[model samples]
Target: MRHDHHGRTHRLELDDQSLRTWDSTVLASDPEDGLVLDRSAFYPGGGGQPPDQGVLLWGGVQTRIVGVRPRDDLWLVPDPDDPLPPVGTQVRGAVDDDRRSLLMRTHSGLHVLRGVMARDFGVPVTGGNMEPGQARLDFDLAEVPAGFKESLTEKLNAEVAADRAIQVRVLPRAQAYALGPIVKTATDLLPPDLEDIRLVDVVGLDLQADGGTHVASTKQIGRIEVAKVENKGRGFRRIRLKLVD
Candidate 1:
Protein backbone atom coordinates (compact mmCIF):
# COMPACT_ATOMS: atom_id res chain seq x y z
CA MET A 1 0.00 0.00 0.00
CA ARG A 2 1.06 3.57 -0.74
CA HIS A 3 1.52 5.89 2.25
CA ASP A 4 0.25 9.45 2.07
CA HIS A 5 0.58 11.22 5.39
CA HIS A 6 0.09 14.98 5.36
CA GLY A 7 -0.72 14.51 1.66
CA ARG A 8 2.89 13.60 0.83
CA THR A 9 4.25 10.21 -0.09
CA HIS A 10 7.70 9.26 1.15
CA ARG A 11 10.32 10.27 -1.43
CA LEU A 12 11.63 6.76 -1.89
CA GLU A 13 15.08 5.55 -2.81
CA LEU A 14 14.18 5.10 -6.45
CA ASP A 15 16.84 6.86 -8.53
CA ASP A 16 19.99 6.80 -6.44
CA GLN A 17 20.85 5.21 -3.11
CA SER A 18 24.12 7.05 -2.62
CA LEU A 19 22.57 9.07 0.15
CA ARG A 20 22.59 6.77 3.15
CA THR A 21 21.53 9.30 5.76
CA TRP A 22 18.34 11.31 5.39
CA ASP A 23 17.69 14.50 7.39
CA SER A 24 13.95 15.04 7.57
CA THR A 25 11.10 15.95 9.83
CA VAL A 26 8.35 13.76 11.15
CA LEU A 27 5.19 14.23 9.15
CA ALA A 28 2.79 12.30 11.30
CA SER A 29 2.83 9.61 13.95
CA ASP A 30 1.25 8.46 17.21
CA PRO A 31 3.30 9.24 20.33
CA GLU A 32 2.34 5.90 21.85
CA ASP A 33 2.88 3.97 18.60
CA GLY A 34 4.73 4.82 15.34
CA LEU A 35 6.96 7.14 13.26
CA VAL A 36 6.23 8.60 9.85
CA LEU A 37 8.77 10.80 8.13
CA ASP A 38 8.41 13.41 5.44
CA ARG A 39 10.86 11.42 3.32
CA SER A 40 12.66 8.15 3.93
CA ALA A 41 15.42 6.04 2.44
CA PHE A 42 14.17 2.84 4.04
CA TYR A 43 12.61 0.16 1.88
CA PRO A 44 9.13 -0.64 3.26
CA GLY A 45 9.16 -4.39 2.59
CA GLY A 46 7.35 -5.20 -0.61
CA GLY A 47 7.48 -7.43 -3.71
CA GLY A 48 9.43 -10.17 -1.96
CA GLN A 49 12.07 -7.70 -0.77
CA PRO A 50 12.28 -7.18 2.98
CA PRO A 51 12.04 -3.92 4.87
CA ASP A 52 15.24 -2.07 5.84
CA GLN A 53 16.67 -1.93 9.36
CA GLY A 54 18.38 1.22 10.62
CA VAL A 55 18.09 3.95 13.24
CA LEU A 56 16.39 7.25 13.86
CA LEU A 57 18.53 10.01 15.37
CA TRP A 58 17.61 13.33 16.93
CA GLY A 59 19.25 15.40 19.69
CA GLY A 60 21.78 12.63 20.25
CA VAL A 61 18.97 10.21 21.04
CA GLN A 62 19.29 7.20 18.72
CA THR A 63 16.34 4.86 18.30
CA ARG A 64 16.89 1.59 16.49
CA ILE A 65 14.41 0.83 13.73
CA VAL A 66 14.11 -2.86 13.07
CA GLY A 67 11.22 -2.80 10.59
CA VAL A 68 9.23 -0.45 8.40
CA ARG A 69 5.73 -1.10 7.02
CA PRO A 70 3.13 0.84 5.06
CA ARG A 71 -0.39 1.30 6.32
CA ASP A 72 -1.92 4.72 5.65
CA ASP A 73 1.65 5.96 6.18
CA LEU A 74 5.14 4.46 6.42
CA TRP A 75 5.16 3.52 10.12
CA LEU A 76 8.64 3.41 11.64
CA VAL A 77 8.75 0.94 14.51
CA PRO A 78 11.42 1.59 17.13
CA ASP A 79 13.41 -1.17 18.73
CA PRO A 80 13.78 -1.95 22.50
CA ASP A 81 10.12 -0.90 22.48
CA ASP A 82 10.76 2.83 22.74
CA PRO A 83 8.05 5.44 22.47
CA LEU A 84 7.91 7.63 19.36
CA PRO A 85 8.74 11.30 19.28
CA PRO A 86 6.05 13.85 18.60
CA VAL A 87 5.11 14.74 15.02
CA GLY A 88 7.10 17.53 13.31
CA THR A 89 10.28 16.66 15.18
CA GLN A 90 13.55 16.64 13.26
CA VAL A 91 15.30 13.35 12.82
CA ARG A 92 17.99 11.67 10.76
CA GLY A 93 17.04 8.36 9.20
CA ALA A 94 19.69 5.94 8.01
CA VAL A 95 19.42 2.49 6.46
CA ASP A 96 21.73 -0.40 7.14
CA ASP A 97 23.85 -0.02 4.03
CA ASP A 98 25.36 -3.49 4.19
CA ARG A 99 21.93 -5.08 4.48
CA ARG A 100 20.47 -2.92 1.74
CA SER A 101 23.43 -3.77 -0.49
CA LEU A 102 22.81 -7.49 -0.09
CA LEU A 103 19.12 -7.02 -0.80
CA MET A 104 19.96 -4.99 -3.91
CA ARG A 105 22.17 -7.74 -5.24
CA THR A 106 19.70 -10.49 -4.39
CA HIS A 107 16.72 -8.61 -5.75
CA SER A 108 18.43 -7.76 -9.04
CA GLY A 109 19.68 -11.31 -9.39
CA LEU A 110 16.11 -12.61 -9.30
CA HIS A 111 15.00 -10.21 -11.99
CA VAL A 112 17.86 -11.28 -14.22
CA LEU A 113 17.07 -14.86 -13.48
CA ARG A 114 13.45 -14.30 -14.43
CA GLY A 115 14.49 -12.62 -17.69
CA VAL A 116 16.85 -15.39 -18.61
CA MET A 117 14.33 -18.11 -17.84
CA ALA A 118 11.70 -16.41 -19.96
CA ARG A 119 14.10 -15.81 -22.80
CA ASP A 120 15.86 -19.14 -22.94
CA PHE A 121 13.10 -21.64 -22.14
CA GLY A 122 10.02 -19.45 -22.62
CA VAL A 123 8.92 -20.38 -19.10
CA PRO A 124 7.24 -17.86 -16.84
CA VAL A 125 8.07 -18.14 -13.16
CA THR A 126 5.01 -18.64 -10.99
CA GLY A 127 6.28 -17.10 -7.74
CA GLY A 128 9.40 -16.09 -5.80
CA ASN A 129 10.79 -14.78 -2.48
CA MET A 130 13.96 -12.90 -1.51
CA GLU A 131 16.02 -13.54 1.60
CA PRO A 132 19.18 -11.98 3.03
CA GLY A 133 21.74 -13.38 0.61
CA GLN A 134 19.51 -15.74 -1.38
CA ALA A 135 16.10 -16.14 -3.00
CA ARG A 136 13.75 -18.84 -4.31
CA LEU A 137 11.56 -18.83 -7.39
CA ASP A 138 8.91 -21.30 -8.45
CA PHE A 139 8.01 -22.38 -11.95
CA ASP A 140 4.99 -24.45 -12.93
CA LEU A 141 6.58 -27.09 -15.11
CA ALA A 142 6.44 -30.83 -15.20
CA GLU A 143 10.06 -31.72 -14.71
CA VAL A 144 13.52 -30.23 -15.09
CA PRO A 145 15.68 -31.50 -17.89
CA ALA A 146 19.23 -32.76 -17.34
CA GLY A 147 21.91 -30.03 -16.99
CA PHE A 148 19.25 -27.37 -16.34
CA LYS A 149 21.10 -25.97 -13.34
CA GLU A 150 24.35 -25.55 -15.22
CA SER A 151 22.58 -23.80 -18.07
CA LEU A 152 20.73 -21.45 -15.71
CA THR A 153 23.86 -20.62 -13.75
CA GLU A 154 25.66 -19.69 -16.94
CA LYS A 155 22.81 -17.43 -18.05
CA LEU A 156 22.57 -15.62 -14.73
CA ASN A 157 26.30 -14.82 -14.68
CA ALA A 158 26.22 -13.74 -18.30
CA GLU A 159 23.49 -11.21 -17.48
CA VAL A 160 25.45 -9.78 -14.54
CA ALA A 161 28.45 -9.43 -16.86
CA ALA A 162 26.29 -7.63 -19.38
CA ASP A 163 26.35 -4.60 -17.01
CA ARG A 164 22.90 -3.42 -17.97
CA ALA A 165 21.62 -0.26 -16.30
CA ILE A 166 18.51 -0.80 -14.23
CA GLN A 167 16.01 1.98 -14.83
CA VAL A 168 12.91 2.98 -12.88
CA ARG A 169 10.04 5.12 -14.12
CA VAL A 170 6.77 6.22 -12.60
CA LEU A 171 4.50 5.84 -15.58
CA PRO A 172 0.93 6.73 -16.26
CA ARG A 173 -1.43 3.77 -16.01
CA ALA A 174 -2.03 3.58 -19.75
CA GLN A 175 1.66 3.79 -20.56
CA ALA A 176 2.48 1.22 -17.93
CA TYR A 177 -0.16 -1.21 -19.23
CA ALA A 178 1.30 -0.94 -22.72
CA LEU A 179 4.53 -2.42 -21.37
CA GLY A 180 2.68 -5.62 -20.36
CA PRO A 181 3.98 -6.44 -16.91
CA ILE A 182 3.93 -10.10 -15.88
CA VAL A 183 1.82 -9.83 -12.76
CA LYS A 184 2.14 -12.64 -10.22
CA THR A 185 -1.52 -12.88 -9.24
CA ALA A 186 -4.97 -12.18 -10.57
CA THR A 187 -5.73 -9.76 -7.76
CA ASP A 188 -4.17 -6.36 -8.41
CA LEU A 189 -1.77 -5.53 -5.59
CA LEU A 190 -1.27 -1.88 -6.48
CA PRO A 191 -3.03 0.75 -4.44
CA PRO A 192 -6.61 1.46 -5.53
CA ASP A 193 -5.99 5.15 -6.16
CA LEU A 194 -2.59 4.55 -7.67
CA GLU A 195 -2.50 6.89 -10.66
CA ASP A 196 1.08 6.06 -11.59
CA ILE A 197 2.73 2.67 -11.85
CA ARG A 198 6.37 2.21 -10.88
CA LEU A 199 8.07 0.32 -13.69
CA VAL A 200 11.35 -1.45 -12.99
CA ASP A 201 13.34 -1.94 -16.17
CA VAL A 202 16.47 -3.96 -16.68
CA VAL A 203 17.44 -2.45 -19.98
CA GLY A 204 17.65 -4.95 -22.86
CA LEU A 205 16.47 -7.56 -20.40
CA ASP A 206 13.30 -7.27 -18.31
CA LEU A 207 10.56 -4.80 -17.47
CA GLN A 208 7.82 -5.08 -14.90
CA ALA A 209 5.69 -3.15 -12.44
CA ASP A 210 7.56 -3.51 -9.14
CA GLY A 211 8.05 -1.84 -5.76
CA GLY A 212 11.45 -2.72 -4.30
CA THR A 213 14.97 -1.43 -3.90
CA HIS A 214 17.62 -2.63 -6.39
CA VAL A 215 21.18 -1.99 -7.47
CA ALA A 216 21.81 0.56 -10.18
CA SER A 217 23.34 -1.91 -12.65
CA THR A 218 23.30 -5.63 -13.21
CA LYS A 219 27.05 -5.77 -12.65
CA GLN A 220 26.57 -4.81 -9.02
CA ILE A 221 24.79 -8.13 -8.57
CA GLY A 222 28.09 -9.97 -9.32
CA ARG A 223 27.18 -13.67 -9.96
CA ILE A 224 24.50 -16.13 -8.93
CA GLU A 225 24.51 -19.81 -7.99
CA VAL A 226 21.53 -22.16 -8.24
CA ALA A 227 21.71 -23.60 -4.76
CA LYS A 228 18.80 -26.04 -4.69
CA VAL A 229 15.71 -27.16 -6.53
CA GLU A 230 12.54 -28.66 -5.03
CA ASN A 231 10.29 -30.71 -7.24
CA LYS A 232 6.71 -30.17 -6.16
CA GLY A 233 4.16 -32.44 -7.79
CA ARG A 234 1.34 -31.20 -10.00
CA GLY A 235 3.82 -29.45 -12.29
CA PHE A 236 5.45 -27.14 -9.76
CA ARG A 237 9.21 -26.71 -9.35
CA ARG A 238 11.05 -24.44 -6.92
CA ILE A 239 14.65 -23.28 -7.37
CA ARG A 240 16.72 -21.71 -4.63
CA LEU A 241 19.56 -19.30 -5.45
CA LYS A 242 22.35 -17.38 -3.72
CA LEU A 243 24.29 -14.29 -4.77
CA VAL A 244 27.95 -15.05 -5.44
CA ASP A 245 29.21 -11.67 -4.22
Candidate 2:
Protein backbone atom coordinates (compact mmCIF):
# COMPACT_ATOMS: atom_id res chain seq x y z
CA MET A 1 0.00 0.00 0.00
CA ARG A 2 1.26 3.44 -0.95
CA HIS A 3 1.49 5.72 2.05
CA ASP A 4 -0.24 8.97 1.12
CA HIS A 5 1.53 11.87 2.83
CA HIS A 6 0.27 15.33 1.95
CA GLY A 7 -2.15 17.36 4.03
CA ARG A 8 -1.12 19.52 7.03
CA THR A 9 2.39 18.11 7.13
CA HIS A 10 4.48 20.97 8.47
CA ARG A 11 7.54 21.42 6.30
CA LEU A 12 10.37 21.68 8.82
CA GLU A 13 12.44 23.51 6.21
CA LEU A 14 9.86 26.24 5.49
CA ASP A 15 11.74 28.65 7.78
CA ASP A 16 14.77 28.30 5.51
CA GLN A 17 13.20 27.53 2.12
CA SER A 18 11.13 29.78 -0.09
CA LEU A 19 7.42 29.02 0.50
CA ARG A 20 6.67 29.72 -3.17
CA THR A 21 8.82 27.01 -4.67
CA TRP A 22 7.25 23.84 -3.30
CA ASP A 23 7.41 20.75 -5.52
CA SER A 24 3.90 19.26 -5.66
CA THR A 25 1.72 16.74 -7.42
CA VAL A 26 -0.70 17.88 -10.11
CA LEU A 27 -3.92 16.71 -8.46
CA ALA A 28 -6.02 18.29 -11.13
CA SER A 29 -7.71 16.84 -14.18
CA ASP A 30 -6.50 19.20 -16.90
CA PRO A 31 -2.84 20.26 -16.70
CA GLU A 32 -2.14 23.95 -16.20
CA ASP A 33 0.86 26.10 -15.32
CA GLY A 34 -0.69 27.53 -12.16
CA LEU A 35 -2.57 24.75 -10.42
CA VAL A 36 -2.98 24.15 -6.71
CA LEU A 37 -0.96 21.24 -5.36
CA ASP A 38 -2.49 18.34 -3.47
CA ARG A 39 -0.43 18.93 -0.35
CA SER A 40 0.24 22.49 0.80
CA ALA A 41 1.71 24.06 3.94
CA PHE A 42 -0.77 26.88 3.51
CA TYR A 43 -3.01 26.71 6.56
CA PRO A 44 -6.45 26.31 5.06
CA GLY A 45 -8.39 28.80 7.18
CA GLY A 46 -8.90 26.90 10.42
CA GLY A 47 -8.86 27.40 14.21
CA GLY A 48 -9.42 31.10 13.50
CA GLN A 49 -6.74 31.99 10.96
CA PRO A 50 -8.69 33.03 7.87
CA PRO A 51 -8.25 30.87 4.80
CA ASP A 52 -5.29 32.09 2.72
CA GLN A 53 -6.16 34.14 -0.34
CA GLY A 54 -3.77 33.72 -3.28
CA VAL A 55 -3.49 33.37 -7.05
CA LEU A 56 -2.44 30.33 -9.05
CA LEU A 57 -0.71 31.40 -12.26
CA TRP A 58 -0.82 28.99 -15.14
CA GLY A 59 -0.22 29.50 -18.87
CA GLY A 60 -1.38 33.12 -19.26
CA VAL A 61 -4.40 33.13 -16.97
CA GLN A 62 -3.90 33.80 -13.28
CA THR A 63 -6.42 31.75 -11.30
CA ARG A 64 -6.94 32.57 -7.66
CA ILE A 65 -7.22 29.80 -5.07
CA VAL A 66 -8.60 32.04 -2.33
CA GLY A 67 -9.54 29.07 -0.18
CA VAL A 68 -7.83 26.03 1.36
CA ARG A 69 -9.03 22.81 2.99
CA PRO A 70 -7.28 20.01 4.89
CA ARG A 71 -8.36 16.50 3.83
CA ASP A 72 -6.51 13.48 5.10
CA ASP A 73 -3.13 14.02 3.35
CA LEU A 74 -4.25 16.61 0.82
CA TRP A 75 -4.65 20.40 0.76
CA LEU A 76 -7.90 20.53 -1.22
CA VAL A 77 -8.45 23.63 -3.32
CA PRO A 78 -12.04 23.48 -4.44
CA ASP A 79 -11.90 24.92 -7.95
CA PRO A 80 -14.18 22.93 -10.15
CA ASP A 81 -13.82 24.65 -13.57
CA ASP A 82 -10.18 25.53 -13.19
CA PRO A 83 -8.19 22.77 -14.80
CA LEU A 84 -5.88 20.78 -12.56
CA PRO A 85 -2.26 20.22 -13.53
CA PRO A 86 -1.27 16.64 -14.37
CA VAL A 87 -0.52 14.37 -11.42
CA GLY A 88 3.25 14.78 -11.76
CA THR A 89 3.58 18.25 -13.28
CA GLN A 90 5.51 20.87 -11.28
CA VAL A 91 4.23 24.40 -10.70
CA ARG A 92 5.13 27.66 -8.94
CA GLY A 93 2.74 28.78 -6.20
CA ALA A 94 2.61 32.26 -4.71
CA VAL A 95 0.57 33.57 -1.79
CA ASP A 96 -1.36 36.83 -1.78
CA ASP A 97 1.45 38.94 -0.34
CA ASP A 98 -0.57 41.71 1.28
CA ARG A 99 -3.18 39.41 2.84
CA ARG A 100 -0.60 36.87 3.90
CA SER A 101 1.54 39.56 5.55
CA LEU A 102 -1.36 40.79 7.63
CA LEU A 103 -2.13 37.24 8.74
CA MET A 104 1.48 36.66 9.70
CA ARG A 105 1.51 39.68 11.97
CA THR A 106 -1.86 38.86 13.43
CA HIS A 107 -0.86 35.28 14.18
CA SER A 108 2.35 36.36 15.85
CA GLY A 109 0.52 38.97 17.88
CA LEU A 110 -1.93 36.35 19.15
CA HIS A 111 0.98 34.24 20.33
CA VAL A 112 2.39 37.20 22.23
CA LEU A 113 -0.94 37.66 23.93
CA ARG A 114 -1.10 33.98 24.75
CA GLY A 115 2.36 34.14 26.27
CA VAL A 116 1.61 37.28 28.26
CA MET A 117 -1.55 35.81 29.75
CA ALA A 118 0.32 32.68 30.71
CA ARG A 119 3.14 34.51 32.45
CA ASP A 120 1.30 37.40 34.12
CA PHE A 121 -2.22 36.09 34.72
CA GLY A 122 -1.59 32.34 34.81
CA VAL A 123 -3.95 31.65 31.94
CA PRO A 124 -3.79 29.14 29.13
CA VAL A 125 -5.39 29.45 25.73
CA THR A 126 -8.67 27.65 25.23
CA GLY A 127 -9.42 28.81 21.70
CA GLY A 128 -8.50 31.52 19.20
CA ASN A 129 -9.14 32.87 15.71
CA MET A 130 -7.37 35.46 13.56
CA GLU A 131 -9.11 37.36 10.80
CA PRO A 132 -7.63 39.82 8.32
CA GLY A 133 -7.82 42.96 10.45
CA GLN A 134 -8.84 41.61 13.85
CA ALA A 135 -8.17 38.67 16.18
CA ARG A 136 -9.78 37.00 19.19
CA LEU A 137 -8.10 34.65 21.62
CA ASP A 138 -9.95 32.75 24.35
CA PHE A 139 -8.24 31.81 27.59
CA ASP A 140 -9.05 29.86 30.72
CA LEU A 141 -9.10 32.50 33.43
CA ALA A 142 -11.22 32.41 36.55
CA GLU A 143 -11.73 36.13 36.81
CA VAL A 144 -11.45 38.93 34.27
CA PRO A 145 -9.48 41.60 36.06
CA ALA A 146 -11.00 45.08 35.94
CA GLY A 147 -7.78 46.83 34.89
CA PHE A 148 -6.20 44.06 32.87
CA LYS A 149 -7.86 45.14 29.64
CA GLU A 150 -6.02 48.44 29.49
CA SER A 151 -2.86 47.05 30.98
CA LEU A 152 -2.75 44.07 28.64
CA THR A 153 -3.35 46.30 25.66
CA GLU A 154 -0.40 48.42 26.67
CA LYS A 155 1.84 45.47 27.46
CA LEU A 156 1.16 43.63 24.18
CA ASN A 157 1.72 46.70 22.03
CA ALA A 158 4.95 47.33 23.90
CA GLU A 159 6.16 43.85 23.05
CA VAL A 160 5.35 44.40 19.39
CA ALA A 161 7.17 47.71 19.44
CA ALA A 162 10.17 45.94 20.97
CA ASP A 163 10.47 43.92 17.74
CA ARG A 164 11.25 40.51 19.13
CA ALA A 165 12.12 37.80 16.61
CA ILE A 166 9.52 35.08 15.88
CA GLN A 167 11.08 31.68 15.34
CA VAL A 168 9.46 28.55 13.73
CA ARG A 169 10.63 24.99 13.37
CA VAL A 170 9.67 21.30 13.13
CA LEU A 171 11.01 19.22 16.00
CA PRO A 172 11.49 15.52 16.45
CA ARG A 173 9.13 14.03 19.06
CA ALA A 174 11.88 13.56 21.62
CA GLN A 175 13.10 17.13 21.33
CA ALA A 176 9.59 18.53 21.43
CA TYR A 177 8.85 16.42 24.52
CA ALA A 178 11.98 17.84 26.17
CA LEU A 179 10.67 21.40 26.05
CA GLY A 180 8.71 22.53 29.10
CA PRO A 181 5.08 21.60 28.53
CA ILE A 182 2.76 24.55 27.93
CA VAL A 183 -0.19 22.64 26.43
CA LYS A 184 -2.26 21.72 29.44
CA THR A 185 -5.23 19.31 29.65
CA ALA A 186 -5.34 18.35 25.97
CA THR A 187 -2.15 16.34 25.67
CA ASP A 188 -4.27 13.86 23.74
CA LEU A 189 -4.93 16.52 21.12
CA LEU A 190 -1.40 15.93 19.84
CA PRO A 191 -1.23 14.08 16.55
CA PRO A 192 0.20 10.58 16.65
CA ASP A 193 3.26 11.73 14.72
CA LEU A 194 4.41 14.06 17.48
CA GLU A 195 7.85 14.03 15.92
CA ASP A 196 6.49 16.00 12.99
CA ILE A 197 4.81 18.72 15.07
CA ARG A 198 5.83 22.27 14.15
CA LEU A 199 6.96 24.52 16.96
CA VAL A 200 6.48 28.29 16.81
CA ASP A 201 8.84 30.00 19.25
CA VAL A 202 9.01 33.67 20.07
CA VAL A 203 12.52 34.39 21.26
CA GLY A 204 12.53 35.33 24.95
CA LEU A 205 8.77 35.27 24.90
CA ASP A 206 6.69 32.20 24.05
CA LEU A 207 6.86 28.69 22.60
CA GLN A 208 3.91 26.86 21.04
CA ALA A 209 3.34 23.90 18.77
CA ASP A 210 1.60 25.54 15.82
CA GLY A 211 1.26 25.13 12.04
CA GLY A 212 0.02 28.58 11.10
CA THR A 213 2.13 31.13 9.24
CA HIS A 214 3.71 34.04 11.16
CA VAL A 215 5.80 37.19 10.81
CA ALA A 216 9.53 37.02 11.37
CA SER A 217 9.38 39.79 13.97
CA THR A 218 6.79 41.41 16.20
CA LYS A 219 7.57 44.95 15.01
CA GLN A 220 5.67 44.34 11.79
CA ILE A 221 2.50 43.85 13.82
CA GLY A 222 2.40 47.58 14.52
CA ARG A 223 0.38 49.02 17.42
CA ILE A 224 -2.31 46.65 18.69
CA GLU A 225 -5.24 47.51 20.93
CA VAL A 226 -7.28 45.23 23.10
CA ALA A 227 -10.69 46.26 21.89
CA LYS A 228 -12.64 44.19 24.39
CA VAL A 229 -12.61 41.38 26.92
CA GLU A 230 -15.59 39.25 27.90
CA ASN A 231 -16.56 36.30 30.03
CA LYS A 232 -17.35 33.12 28.15
CA GLY A 233 -17.89 30.71 31.01
CA ARG A 234 -17.25 30.09 34.68
CA GLY A 235 -13.52 30.25 34.13
CA PHE A 236 -13.12 31.38 30.52
CA ARG A 237 -12.49 34.86 29.16
CA ARG A 238 -12.12 36.00 25.58
CA ILE A 239 -9.92 38.86 24.44
CA ARG A 240 -10.58 40.69 21.22
CA LEU A 241 -8.08 42.99 19.46
CA LYS A 242 -7.31 45.00 16.37
CA LEU A 243 -4.48 47.04 14.87
CA VAL A 244 -4.26 50.77 15.54
CA ASP A 245 -2.15 53.77 14.59
lDDT of 2 at 72: 52
Q: Pick the candidate with the highest TM-score.
A: 1
1-245: candidate 1 lDDT, tens digit per residue:
34212235465576555557988898776644568888888877888899889988887688788987677667877785655667788998889999998998899888898787767666667778998799998887676889988888888898899999998777777778877764533245776677777777899888877878888999999879999878977878888999876
For model 1, what is the alpha-carbon lDDT of residue 181? 62
What tens digits encode model 2's per-residue C-alpha lDDT throughout 1-245? 12123443443224542264354445543322233365454556644678666655555654457576555543546355665555565555566767777777888889889878877877667777778768998887887767989999989988898899988776676777689873532234776755466678888888877767788888988889999998888987889988774
* Candidate 1: Cα lDDT at 223: 76
TM-score of each: 0.90, 0.82
Model 2 TM-score, all chains together: 0.82
Task: Assess each prediction's global lDDT (C-alpha) against the native.
Answer: 0.79, 0.68
How many residue pairs of model 1 clash at the backbone? 0
Off by over 4 Å in 1: 1-9, 29-32, 81-83, 182-193
Model 2 ranges off by over 4 Å: 1-13, 16-25, 30-41, 78-90, 184-188
Clashes of each: 0, 7
